[model samples]
Target: MKMMKNFRNEDGFSLIELLFSITVLSVGLLGIASTIPFGYKAIEQSAKRSTAASLLNEGLEKLKGYQYINLIESNFPDEVYGDIPDFPDFARTYEIRMASDVYSSPIPELKMVTITVFWRVSATNEQRIFAVTYIGQRR
Candidate 1:
């Protein structure tokens, strides 16, 4: 008789238990689904930053190849590219100026080359990254 009673209690999960389990599982799945959009946006932001850094490096490399004086002759133009290019909503610019305040700074012997990469962060806001390097007169 005792064995029969125990068997009756252990037959299977009750209807209330099944409903509770399903409710908990559904909540967990919903929590997971809410994070997907945030993850995708984060990935997008990281890619843009990487491209900006790459553009900065390329600009600096070209500057390294030129005579320090040549770059100072004219103001560098604003570099801009579209989504069709590697970086989306991106514009990069460079400036060659004398890094020092002394009299000799007028010459190109010591120059401060600024490479800046800018991007549209939002509809009304923009962000930029810059690299400053000094090109000394290498005798």
Candidate 2:
């Protein structure tokens, strides 16, 4: 009978308990809110990297379409800075050099082609990606 009377009198949580719960919840929400910006930054960086890689691959593919004899530095000289067709923030450049210059044992018909893609992620941050391939006579 005595235990039942005590249980009936304690109908709801005390003021201190309610305050503690509110404080814990607020801290947890603040922690989650603090991480959102970092998550957005990471996703943005990944997207930029993907775009740079695609640009590098596109440049390399175009070079591969040229004839082996035509793969000379005269045809595709090193570019200083060139903008992407539709991507305003990104730029691309390429260099075509003799394989002999880069490799110790190089074939006479081999030419080294390098494609580079670059972009600025922020005022102080820059990102770049590149691809290299050796082209030789088709025969």
Best by lDDT: 2
Each prediction's whole-model lDDT (CA): 0.79, 0.80
RMSD of each: 3.7, 3.3
Clash pairs, candidate 1, are: none
lDDT per residue, candidate 2, 79-110, as tens digits?
43344567777877778877887776448867
Output the worst ten-in-a-row residue range by lDDT, candidate 2. 76-85
Q: Which residue runs of candidate 1 sit more than 4 Å off their true CA positions?
A: 1-8, 73-75, 81-88, 102-108
- Deviation of model 2 at 133, angstroms: 0.6
Runs of candidate 2 with Cα error greater than 4 angstroms are 1-8, 77-82
Task: Summarize candidate 1's per-residue lDDT along 1-139 as a digit string, tens digits.
Answer: 9989897888689899999999999999999999999999999889888988988888888786677557773646776757326565898888777777434566556777788898887998888899988778868
